[model samples]
Target: MGAGFSRRAFLQAALPASSALAFFSTSFRRDSLISAATSTKPQKVIVVGAGLAGLIAAFELMQSGHDVTLLEARMRPGGRIHTMRDQFSDGLYAEAGAYDFTDAYVLLCQRCFLPSR
Candidate 1:
């Protein structure tokens, strides 16, 4: 335990490291691991809601070669992450929900959307 150490940070770093070690060890082959991670037969997936969690889940499923159908009851996506525009007299806008995010959320967004180097 250190000054800034937390369970979240430890798990974040350790999970990937453990998976990498398991796949890259002499017992496993790189090609075999890659093929195993990908689907040989694509399957249809239905994801309820287009919120942040559901959107990310659908994206991941599609990336893994699955056909994903995202359903949202709202008129638009981003379930609770909504902003009201042009509803005020002075043309001011307001956020109805999810206006702010934490450092961990920002990091997760970067990891999800940013291209790997």
Candidate 2:
């Protein structure tokens, strides 16, 4: 055997490629995989509050074949996104909360910094 050659080493390297080949050639169609997910039975889901997080959760649950009802105590859908037009001049309004969405905010969300238990 050569200085850098062994049967164990060759088998370890070839296993992953062969496994991938078998996976791709399976009977399941790759392109229609999304459409193949069977629609789940309709379930009743009540979401508390109409905040951004609550709205997102409700939307996702509805898409997965669940009947979602949003319950908001406030008069508006946005929880803390308050705008007062009376205090400002004519044709003017003030945003008391909720900053503008940006690309950096998305990049920040993509990163996971918290340690898992």
Candidate 3:
């Protein structure tokens, strides 16, 4: 759930850059919500997958001022971040197929990791 939320937020943050500006310029002007004085509006975007790369891209696009939606094929998010904690004892954590993260991953984690419940 947390990963899903984070993914959504990332997409929302990067909405603009990922969309077609020409499309947004023409389509959004039709909305009564925007006034003639308002020349431009945010673009609508759909992002496939919810992995670190996808989510990061979505976030970057959204941060540029667009609307974003994220879609995932799996039942849960976290992608390769999946764990098998339940299969291990307390103080033990295991990655089914993934190992440690990289420097870029560390940067992303610092910038976008979801807040704790």
Name every residue pair that clashes in candidate 2: none
- State model 2's lDDT: 0.66
Taking every candidate in turn, the Cα RMSD to the unseen true structure, in Å, is: 12.4, 19.3, 13.8
Candidate 3 lDDT, 3-83, residue by residue in tens: 557877888867765576535644553334224323456778898888765676476567657688989999876677787
lDDT of 1 by residue, 1-117 (tens): 587998889989989997987467647653464365474678888998887756765766677798889999898998898888877767688878775554434544787786322
What are the Cα lDDT values of the candidates? 0.72, 0.66, 0.64
Q: Is candidate 1 or candidate 3 better by lDDT?
A: 1
Worst 10 residues of 1 by lDDT: 99-108
Model 2 lDDT tens row, 1-117: 467988788889889997996578465553353243225567788998886556655765666677889999998987777888999899999887676643323433444343322
RMSD of 3: 13.8
Top-TM-score candidate index: 1
Error of 3 at 6 (Å): 32
Candidate 3 ranges with C-alpha deviation above 4 Å: 1-41, 85-93, 97-104, 113-117
Candidate 1 colliding pairs:
none
Ranking by lDDT: 1, 2, 3
Residues forming the 10-long window of minimal summed lDDT in candidate 3: 29-38
